[model samples]
Target: MSTGQTRSDRKPAPVKMVTTDTGRILRISPEDESARAAVAAAATPAPQNIDPARRTDVLFRVRRAEGHELSSWWMVGAFVVTSGLVIALLSWVPYSA
Candidate 1:
């Protein structure tokens, strides 16, 4: 019985076999290789003029947040609510002897 999927009579495209410098064989489609090359060329950024003297030695700095303090009241409340819910659910379940 057919699964309602139409089978194409067209043959599969031939793939090109390439040998890498590391003696590895790769089977790549011509269309895929060309498209990959095109993408790589497009993704390459142009070189920008950078000043050597103006370059900062520090890459990033980590600092503490000012006036942003966390309170433990919310954590305590959430814990109490979840514990009460678990106890309630356990009590609701019928105990089997």
Candidate 2:
């Protein structure tokens, strides 16, 4: 530690480490604008080292789910049905005149 050093002069921990249920080590970092890009770049596995099914993007799981052919239709239908049901039930409720 040097007395002349300002806060910015010190780089924060590269990444905070975590242990998964499967006993694999993971490095998680706060992903603000600057840190997100930097962490993504740093965490990208080498071509030979990566699993083909895994992705490093922020919404990897969502992106994968988004690939379904009927996902959008299902989402829209669910919203319409739920809202319609709620509104219909409320409309039928007896209100004090």
Candidate 3:
């Protein structure tokens, strides 16, 4: 009764428009064979239904260290000799000069 405006004449509320894809156009169809193959290949492989009795928890390696065994033996011998000499000197009481 105040302005005499009809319902059809009322303007719609403005919407805050936003594009998630950065306004770039892309053409893709589900019927494309390449897209289907890519989706399948990128998916994780399904778990196999194997017998639990045949399962193994052990892992084996055939690799060897690059260092020589001779060097290790030399290090052990040196440590033993040095320790023995230190013990002998500490155990010996000096006869005062």
Candidate 4:
């Protein structure tokens, strides 16, 4: 007895709604793949600049640790011993500079 298409029998269309600050409702029903792709691409995040204060703080921390001197005699001794071993290793190699 029913002559019209029922809601259960019909395929639903894509509904996208965006609201503006001026009380405007934008209802967009994109009909093509290119329009959907354009919307998707536009929504992607672009790169932003580093905060100057944060960057300066990081740079300051790096430079703050730089000028502090360490009297590391033990480390120097270990390095000299390692260098001697490397020199000895190089002596075993034929025609090495």
- Candidate with best TM-score: 2
Q: Please give, for residues 42-82, the per-residue lDDT of candidate 3 as tens digits.
A: 66653467433333542442334466235588889999999
Give the Cα error of residue 93 in candidate 4, in Å: 0.2
CA lDDT scores, all candidates in order: 0.65, 0.62, 0.54, 0.64
Please give the lDDT score at residue 45 for candidate 4.
48
Each candidate's TM vs. the true structure?
0.32, 0.35, 0.24, 0.27
- Strongest candidate by lDDT: 1
Indicate the residue-level lDDT of 50 in model 2.
49
Report the lDDT tens digits of candidate 4 across residue range 4-82: 9666966678878764333347566766556656655666443366443355335543322456755589789999999
When 2 and 3 are scored with TM-score, the better candidate is 2
Per-residue lDDT over 1-97 for candidate 1, one digit per residue giving the tens place of the 0 to 100 score: 9999998999889887765433347677866888656654655453356333233543443333676545689889999999999888888789832
- Least lDDT summed over 10 consecutive residues: which range in candidate 2? 55-64
Q: Encode model 2's per-residue lDDT on 1-97: one tens digit a residue.
A: 7899567767785676755333357667665447545655666345665444564543443324555645588899999999999888888888923
Q: What is the clash count for each candidate, in the order shown? A: 0, 0, 0, 0
Q: Tell me, what's the RMSD of every candidate?
A: 15.5, 11.2, 21.9, 18.2
**What lDDT is obtained when candidate 1 is compared to the true structure?**
0.65
